[model samples]
Target chain A: MVTSAAPRHAAPPVHAGPARMTATPPPIPTLLDSDVVRPAPPASRAIKAQVENFSFFYSTVQALADVSLPFRERAITALIGPSGCGKTTLLRCFNRMHDLYPGNRYVGRILLHPDNLNIVAREVDPISLRMRISMVFQKPNPFPKSIFENVAYGLRLRGIRSRSELEGRIQVALEDAALWGEVKDRLRKPAYDLSGGQQQRLCIARALANEPEVLLLDEPTSALDPIATSRIEDLIVELKERVTIAIVTHNMQQAARISDYTAFMYLGKLIEYGATAEVFQNPKCKETEDYVTGRFG
Target chain B: MSTILSDNPVSGGIAGSRNGGLLPPLRSRSLLGRLAERFIESGLLLAAAFSVLITGGIVFVLVSESLPFFRHVSAREFLTDRLWTPMFADPHHGIMPLVAGTLTTTAVALLVAMPVGTLIAVWLSEFAPSRLREVLKPALELLAAVPTVVYGYFAVDFVTPALQAFIPDLPTFNMLGPGIVMGVMIIPYVSSLSEDAIRAVPMLLREGSYALGAGKFTTAMRVVYPAAFSGIASAYVLAISRAVGETMIVAIAAGQQPNLSFNPLDPAATITAFIVQVSLGDLPHGSIGYQSIFAAGVTLFVMTLGFNIIGAVMRRRYRQAY
Candidate 1:
């Protein structure tokens, strides 16, 4: 299943076995050479969004430095990095979430495909741009409202006031988020009454209500239990057929289980980017290999 | 329960000792210490009861004084009568005109305060820079600290003249001047309380709205305002009650004449203004005029109490539990 997703990649090298992963292996001198090459990704996938030479800053401090990568259409791309490594920062740049705060700055172009609009450009209004690229936060932060209203919030923002239209879209979004079965009978109940897992799905339903092309998840299941984590992982894998997804996760197992493509970032640089199997099993960079092999975060 | 108690070795030993000749410790207290503790407890209880006691006393006085006025003037007449001319030869004790005066001024005040105050609150919460918020919040609060009488004078000397320019025939002492000035006086209350409520709305909710492509205005009005509905509504209701009970402002600027006119340009007397008007005069203690103050006081008390009840109900009804 993993190999078919990126058929151009050769078979996984035998030396890349987990048992061979070492903490004290001598650094390869060939890797230090500029001729170090990364495996090419399959050419079948279309680009959904591109971050070109993107640098991000919070007030005076720079968060991401010259980071560039392409998100494949209808594919799940997981951003893996330690805390404060610009993984979440780069994810937020896709939908311009940083524009809400005053001092945070996006210093490079993030081009959304088809029309090729730079998300951080002067002409694009962050408010309207968000409709096409919605985001679910780190914690399941559903509005303090009913289950139905929580899912319907984004639709209401778009001025869809008809009862039938709202009910229809809300049903679809909830069904898509796989929360309709448990919550359909008590849609009027407050979202807070739901467990942590249900609330996270409700948030996903909220983002899906806008019919966004790309969905960003920032450490979505960090607050959930193991059962909820696997449920969300399964939901992400299924959702990739309909929407392009970029998730920032600290959990390497979650990234490996769900994402088709993976980007490893360290400090502020894009350390590695390729098909998920290649990045995880046959990492090109020493930092990527070490981090993926569990030598260090 | 006995088996559970016996499960603890320490308690079982104590129980065994109790069954023997040993008695529990007396925890002997000095007489002075006992007295002091009792005295402090009584003092605390008295302090807790003081407010209820004062409220009961006020109700007793009001009802006792108002009974005599109701004897001459029927309860129906006092409640339903259009005129309120107790000082006149005929001595009409109708309070509707005073009520109309209070309602008119409160309506006018709310008209000015509600929108302006809510907008100010939104700006302070969502838009104001940190340094600007630090400066603006205390400055807005200073408006509330100004004495009502000072506000009354400002109404008469400044607001009345400024309004008179546009409204040429506007009375020198009209409900509009005091009502507008009272609105200004209570702006800080509405703005500060509502600002606190709006600010208390979780940042996550606002971020959720923004992520859904909602503009700042949309988020503030649709999400933040509704999320903080109970607090904002209660703030407005409390402001309205303050406007209704405002004495010095209406007493000075709103004329003593109990005109039952709805037009704000005309001079009118609020229930509070009438109380102030009657108290300033040298009437005998048991006279109808003297007793009429308590009747009006009772009316003002009931009206303000109703507002408080409504505000409390609103605070609970729409409270968005995070």
Candidate 2:
């Protein structure tokens, strides 16, 4: 029997091992080729976050259902679909932003395997989880502060108070985000002085300052112009070498251009996932092909 | 007014409303509109000019009345001396006592108002749910609508009794009771202003802070709070000025005894309370006794105006929101 697993609170293991996955595709059209020749990358062998029968609920309504997939370690993974396809919700689940809202929850098995453990345990400290998986938002959301303080905000949270230490971390993080040269001299200036694209890069730098192992971007360049978008795309390419990256983007071309691995999600289901090139060029699932080729969401 | 009179494109410019780094010559329209426009525009301008006229009249009245007091008591002595006793046969009054008392009460009141009001504002804006937040915000603002005299009554009866229990030797009428109650009255003003400011912080900033592993408290303080500080501070300064000028609470609850003392447990009078004490019943108009009240009013006006101006400057210096 095919396993119908789910993502939820409580240790997902101990009750199971070597689980089966679901076959439901998302709101996006699955490509015909994704069914036949999904090019699973060698890096997927080192899966970091594994979901089995992963289902989500906003109070009572289930947003996602029976999603079984492994997020590959140390690669840029893209979650692509039309709006309300549960991509952003799925991303939020990885760090539990839903905890702030009342009665909202996730059910089933989501496993983060550094210690090879399940992540959905009731005892999981969400703060630490968030520290490991830092997120940059769709809009450039800098604090009302100097550029230096904006980047130092995360480090200050972990109790690094020394100015010199904060400065060095700020420099390294900005360099990591590919924003050092543009903003290095104007560290004392207010963050609002920067252009829309620069502010987004500054946010990326801010997230990296905490030395997070994974970076999650939810449409990080959606508010930016074309020039800023390209700058961020370049930054994302450099960043993949240092830390794992996951992005949820509406722009499929952007997903195709920058991602190492791509998951096509439509109607709250992950329809097809494989190599970025494969998912775009020759998707096995017919729905993915239609969505990719601009037939329909 | 100029808008109706001037069909000239120069209306959009102090210099010129240049776009894309290129200057265009002023565009004009309808010569007929320009002809009758001056008379109509002048009438509107004159209407607008009345506000300035009213302000100038008040200032002229104040200066004319105050000129005699300055000849008898230099501005230096009136400002620096702490004791005020113009009612005494010898008449050795000083404005310092009133000024000091006003500052002390206002400062202490701010200590109370700023924290309580800011916390309530934060709760109203960021933490509370939509339905509850909607209900709570207006309810908090209703605190401001209550008559100051009612606050004075509450302070006299409820607040003074409570204080007497703690201090054992508390006065029946003291600045402490009135100042605290006055702080409570100003809470809505602070909260309303701060709530608007905090709500103005974009949702993205809060979401970004949350994503960085910061708790709600951390996000509110480090991110949201600082972003809204300019507006919140203006609210606080306004509250201070209100506290200094507040008459009913202090006049009825805090005994009108002008002295250079800050011990809130002891009876003391602010400028407003002193003015109220003097103004009660006719005290021979044009006498030094009656004129003293105007002197206090002028000082009160100047103090409040200074606070307003300084608050404005600081707000402009740090203009930022995100």
| Consecutive 10-residue window with the lowest summed lDDT within model 2 chain B | B12-21
Q: Of the candidates shown, which would achieve the greatest DockQ relative to the real structure? A: 1
- Score residue A91 of candidate 2 by CA lDDT: 86
DockQ comparisons of all candidates to the true complex: 0.51, 0.50
Give the CA lDDT, 0 to 100, for residue B102 in model 2: 81
Q: How does residue B30 of candidate 2 score in lDDT?
A: 58
What TM-score, to 2 decimals, does candidate 1 have?
0.81
Instruction: Calculate model 2's interface RMSD in Å.
Output: 1.3
Cα lDDT of model 1 by residue, B231-269, tens digit: 999899889888988899999998899988888999999
Residue-wise C-alpha lDDT for candidate 1, range A1-297, written one tens digit per residue: 112222122212321234232444434422212211223336559998999999999999999999999998988899997778999989888878888778988788999998899998968988889999999998888877889888888898888999999999999999999999999899999888899999999999999999999999999988887777767776877798899999998877667656778999999899999887667766789898877666677
lDDT of 2 by residue, A214-292 (tens): 7889998878766678778767867877787889987765675567788888777889988876777757798878777
The ten-residue window of minimal lDDT in model 1 chain A covers A1-10
The per-candidate TM-score of the B chain, in the order shown, comes to 0.87, 0.86
Q: Root-mean-square deviation of each candidate, in angstroms? A: 8.5, 10.0
